[model samples]
Target: MKPVADATPKVTKSEREWRDELTPAEYHVLREAGTEPAWTGEYVDTKTVGVYQCRACGAELFRSETKFDSHCGWPSFFSPLAEDRVILREDRSLGMVRTEVLCATCHSHLGHVFEGEGYPTPTDQRYCINSISLTLVSESDQG
Candidate 1:
């Protein structure tokens, strides 16, 4: 069996610190584990080539090559840039059980992931991420 992912985060900060660091919307999604409205995220329809990093802490999470349009009203990725960069936990909110994706470094909530959706992705999984929780670094801007 595959080893269980680590639950400990590399960075820790108080709620007030996070609030001061992030914008209201970003704090809602990243710290409070909230979801953005459907089709309303900045990255939902973006097709740029680059990497998406955690908004709370600049940690590379997903690559542009892994992104795909799932029409699920959020940015979707087949997989994370690296497994260790993300942490998955069982979320049982809103009367549903789902896997919650978080930044491993900061433990900020990025979004939820669903599997067995029959997408053409290599992993057949969809990581529905919130645009507010991510900041894209376009290929041209990468140094």
Candidate 2:
């Protein structure tokens, strides 16, 4: 079967425009598709109730309810808030084939997703995300 085409609208920006919008670390991960050091991400062990939004575009991506401690040294989510909120594409980098997750609106790289790890989630998928690529809006602040 053919892969389904992404329906999310594309976002276009110049390199300088992206650089100006994101921080150095954010630019590296979101724009350059780089990974932060394991266990060093801001949300790696965060356990607060909140909504995680894309740092680049402020689009809601994941919720705290879907987060789990995968012990993989990154903020892990079992699923996104909505299928259209994020996009996944095949990534063949660093000598590995993996599915890369990106912000659906901004096309900024968030991280990767892996399957069949036997996690106790609705889906057996793990979304390993970069903390720098997200912004958490705590439940208390959602009012």
Clashes of each: 0, 0
Q: Which stretches of candidate 2 lie over 4 Å from their true place?
A: 1-10
lDDT of each: 0.91, 0.90
In the range 1-143, model 1's lDDT, one tens digit per residue, is 12246666788999999999999999999999999999999999999999999999999999999999899999999999988888888888979978989899999999998999899989998999999999999999997
lDDT per residue as tens, model 2, 7-81? 655677889999998889999999999999999999999999999999988899999999999999999999999
- The numbered model that scores best in lDDT is 1
Candidate 2 lDDT (Cα, whole model)?
0.90
- TM-scores of the candidates are 0.95, 0.93
Where's the lowest-lDDT run of ten residues in candidate 2?
1-10
